[model samples]
Target: MTTIELDTTKLRADRLFQRKRLVGFAIPAVILAYLTYIFFAFDLPGLAGRANMDNAVTLVSDSWSHKVHVTRDNRSGEISYAVEGERKGRYPEGARPAWVTGDEVITIDLGGDHIVRYLPENRTEIEIPNFPLIEVRAEGRSLVTNLPDDLPGWISASNRRIGITTPEGRITLTGARTEVFNYFPGWELFWFTLDSPYHGQSLSKILFGERVDPARPNISGAMSDWWNNAMWRHKDVAWAIGETILMAFLGTMGAAIIALPLGFLAAKRFSPIMLLRAATRRLFDFVRGVDALIWTVVLARAFGPGPLTGALAILITDTGTFGKIFSEALENVDQKQIEGVSSTGAKPLQRYRFGVIPQLVPVLLAQILYFLESNTRSATIIGAITGGGIGLMLTQAIQTQKDWEEVAYYIVLIIAMVMFMDWLSGWLRGKLIGRKD
Candidate 1:
């Protein structure tokens, strides 16, 4: 009865709530309807068609694909596939060639009624005579010499399994050192394999035979090649990396030399003179505020390209960073030591040399090592801007769109180099900072 005189305001609020819910539902429904119309209206098929067409054109025009390569796939065991020309035998065009037509294909008989045939078309097929399924030879660093009569062609030999064939099986050699693989036409085994002897052979010779491999999956030979050449050959990559490291080293070292003197001038504990401290602090701020890339461009424009430009850029950028860091390091030093040094009538430079530097050097070196790692990558960027070092090579490779092989090479090289630097820097830090027992 009390509520019989319904509060009109509460009823109005309830109606408003219902209206809000309806509006929310209606808004989403309208959005869904619009989306549905767009999905149906837009020509998604045309977009997909255009993308496929572009890929086809690019693949057709690419010259590298024409190059013959060793192919290893799950279906086809280690086999040779021609990049260009007509198909041979029952093998589909470019399916897998036995031996390149012109180039000598090696045929070997390992006995046990096994026939290794190097087909005229650059491929190897091995038949176990009575065996039902084909047997693909395992690629190994070691090779056997007995020639199989059923071999389709002359067999070339090596500790590295560059090329070998049989009637129904083929083995493409692969390992840590040797790299050969092929990716075009779906067979990736030949991409980084040793260059095929019949790489430039006629189209007919390209399709000697195809092998079958029920076991073993296709590995990225190109990536393997990069790993071996760039990373495994750590010693070789170290030199280029050293250049970058040297740049960072010199940059950090030179910056430290300059920062030490200036940082003292900037610190209040050391430089009680307000004007001197203010100027030094402002200078530090100004230098550190600018981006390293901007500094790189500016110095490159001013000095032209080379290690000198890269070193100078690193020097300029690091100087600001060093000044800021060294100042903080200086500020954090125990003040009691300064009073002790001063109480002994030690000169300002003497007091700083004894009191400030002992504490600051450890911090400075830690920061430097960190900066060395940081600047190693920066040096690559700086080198690209200045047209120096491997970075320059990488930039050119990327610009030309030359197969990503070279880019991969340089990237692996840089990563290896950075890892080495990290190891070396850590060792040095331990030696310098760790107390001798």
Candidate 2:
């Protein structure tokens, strides 16, 4: 009998090991099959062919660099020098870049032996090292160019327009105008536009040196110019950032206020009515499951697009989430404390106020502060759809396609804003919760 019992136990152990081995192999096989299905379903091979790597390279490079435009009107024979080809950044009359010379001919030396000469009669001359000179003459409604048929990929020419792209700069010739773009590192005119007297002055000079603008004090004038900088719109950006913070604050706090009662209704321990609890739970699920983006679109139509619309969208979505979280927290509260308060002959409301709320405070505060930080980032994206905050500025900059340096600036500001919010949330949490080491 002993031998038979030992044999049965050994056989059972062997079968368990065999089952484990089969599960391990089967799990990996199922995962591999799912991955194979996803690879074909996503059509990754076709996507590779559609990707344009050269455009991606250009976009990445542009985000870090700026370009100055030297454009000439072919019909009027008037030439203008502007940073990023913006009127706000146009160089004052009688002033020009050092690299450009000759008033009559207007010689532009794009470093590395690549030069462009704007001549009379709307004729343009391009000289590239180790290559034949390319000449283009813009006549009324047509462009005549001497570009060879075997020109490199960088040069595109036709009877109506001619485009030359080089490492140093780009030149485009057409029947209406001839433009030259000179690339340079760093954001130009970030603090002040070309018209400002403080444009070229150093910070130390502005702080300690003699007044540059005779009409105003040096430091005060510099501050005014920077704050009102037309090219960078510093004032506008500051206001937009404030709007985003406001949206997050109003939305998160309002949702907390509205969800607390709903949470009590949903929690079984607090509310004994099962039908009411189920209805409240379904309401929470309905709002929370709809996604913030969809809510933003629906609210935008009702509220007509502003920071208020964004705040309302966040409020509605977070209300459902807070209801669910608060209900869970309520369901897990210690009943011993409640019973002790009840033993003191305290009323129902008093017992809840003293016993239940104290236990819920830590969880409520922690969740509220966390969502405050998270909703700040969400507000930025929601603001884009609602036409309100820094996100709208970022969207406009990206849509312009030429102001990539500004896009980079907005991205940096957004990152800094998020980091600051995270720090603020953690500090508040520590202060309110009696820091947990």
Candidate 3:
């Protein structure tokens, strides 16, 4: 080749290499610039400053522990002991906790060196190790305290109220009441309320020993009390769980049943008309693209909130997804089996049943079962919006901001439900379609 031609070829190769190198460096530089913008745009640097660690820490601690409230009414001079301050968990008449002592002046020992005494005439005494004795008096619409102006971080005081926090417990003095909350490690009164005769009985005593309640048999009474326990509401929770599962089942199955026929209409092989195929495909996109939660809100507004509303929302959203998937599967199906079925003089519906459907069963079952498990979790969130299932109970518990233990309980139940659904779906797949692994 000529020298001029050789020089031109070398120049072209060098320019091509430079262009490729520039493109590679430019792509990452663009990504880096975008991420840099996002970091400040999202205010990530100020996230820690915006967080309330005290409330977060308290919430985490409350989820695993229970507290008993020792409340004294300043107006009536009446003292009451209740678990988590719930009236249903209040101590019976003439009954009190072991930690409480004294007849007229009630003394509460909060396990460490923390002690609280409900003095006469709406006065309270608090003693903590390494600190001076703090006294407070709750009068009408105001508080009188020995707390200094230069107070510690653990103490919050105002003219009308005073709050003290220590490792052992928390104390609050107000114009209307004086309350001391002593925290314990486990959920109290979970099995039976204070009204139930089985509240203090041991497992062995209730099961094998004498009758705990004279009104009913030992086992039967114990079972009944636990089921109807006002604090836990086991029956209500069970029904909510059932409702969530029903929503998932009805929605998933309903979607699959409706999508199967619509799939045939969207497939190029089955649908000869371009307009019909395009319309069906667009319908699938329109429904699926809007999202399940959006559909949930719309349906809830129209139909009103219920389990059926949640189910219909799920059905509408999943039908679009299943239609798109089924249509694609239909388009890729083997035509030889269809031809053989036709040669046997099988009519359209019969050919579809024997030929098209048989080929699609494994795919159909696999997708259906997988979606059923996914929809189970989706139903939980949908139930929250529709006011129907365990999700509603969970939302209520979380909103209360005091019942973190119940929130924890509902969360654990939801995780367990999802795990069970996962196992059940896998088992069904194994039995009906044969497991791949």
Candidate 4:
């Protein structure tokens, strides 16, 4: 009998080993099959072939650098110098950059021996260190260039336009205008635009030296100029950030308020009715399963794009989430505590207020505070769709394509805002629920 029992145990162990081996091999085989399907489905190789590395490099460079545009109208022969080609950043009348010389024939000295000369009567000349001199003349509605038939990759010339790209700068000649872009490090006019009195003054001089603006005090005038800067729009950014925070706060708190009662209705222990519990659970699933982005789009159409719409979207989505979580917490409550309250002849509402709430407070507050922090980031994305908050400014900056520095600034502010929310949530959590360790 002992021999038979041992033989039976050995047979079972061998079968179990075979089953485990089959599972291990099958899991990897399934994963490999899925990955193979995805590789062909995504067309990754075709995407790689179509990507432009030069444009990617230029976009990355533009994020950290600024460009000065020197444009001369071919028809009127009028020259203009501007930062990033914006009207607000245009140089004051009759004022040109130090690198440019000659009034009649404007000479733009791009560093590293690259020079561009804008002569009278729609004539232009570009000289690079190792390359031959390029001369282009714009007449009527066409561009005349001394470019070879077999030109290099950097130069693209046609009857209507001539484009030259170099390491130091880029020069483009067209029938309507001749433009030269000189690259420089850092964001130009970030602190103050050309119109501001404090444009060129050093920080130390502005703080301690004589008044720069004759009409107002040094510090106040400087502060006002920086705060209301037209180019950077500091005031607008601050207001947008405030709106984002307000959206997140309203959405998270409002969801918590609405979810608490719904949570009780969903909890099987609190609501004995099977139909009611199932309906509440289904409602929670429907709201949350749709996703916040979908809610944002749907609500935006109903209410129009605004912070309030984003707030309502967040509130609706989070209400479902909070209801589910709170219901689970309610279901796990100590039955002994509820029974003790009932023995004291306490009413149903009072029993819940005293017995159930104390137990669920920590879990509810923890979830709410955690969601508040997470929702802050969610609100930024929601605001972008709803056309409000810092996300709108970020989207606008990205759409411009030339305002990458502004994009970088907005990204920094968004990160700082998230960090601040994280810290605030942690503090609130600690205050409400005593720290664990």
The 10-residue segment with the lowest total lDDT in model 1: 209-218
Segments of candidate 1 deviating more than 4 angstroms: 1-98, 102-239, 343-345, 435-437
Winner on TM-score (1 vs 2): 2
Residue 206 Cα positional deviation in candidate 1, in Å, after optimal superposition: 31
The alpha-carbon deviation from the true structure for residue 312 of candidate 2, after best TM-score superposition, in angstroms, is 0.8
Task: TM-score for candidate 1, please give it.
Answer: 0.51
The candidate maximizing TM-score is: 2
What candidate 3 gets wrong by more than 4 Å, as runs, is 1-30
Residue pairs whose backbone atoms clash in candidate 3: none
Reference-based lDDT, each prediction = 0.60, 0.93, 0.92, 0.92
Highest-lDDT candidate: 2
Least accurate stretch of 10 residues (summed lDDT) in model 4? 428-437
lDDT of 1 by residue, 1-437 (tens): 35745787678889999999999999999999998888778966567766777545443434233323333332333344433211221233343444333335544443455544454322345555543423233334343334443544434444444354443333454322211222233222222222322222333433332211123212332333434442124333446566777787888788888888898898887788999999988888887777678888888788888777888888887888899988888889998888899999999889878877788888998988778777878888887888776677668766766334445657767888778787778878889887322
Error of 4 at 322 (Å): 0.8
Clash totals in order: 51, 0, 0, 0
Off by over 4 Å in 4: 1-11, 341-345
Reference-based lDDT, residue 317, model 1? 78
Prediction 3 global C-alpha lDDT:
0.92
**Ten consecutive residues with minimal summed lDDT in candidate 2?**
428-437
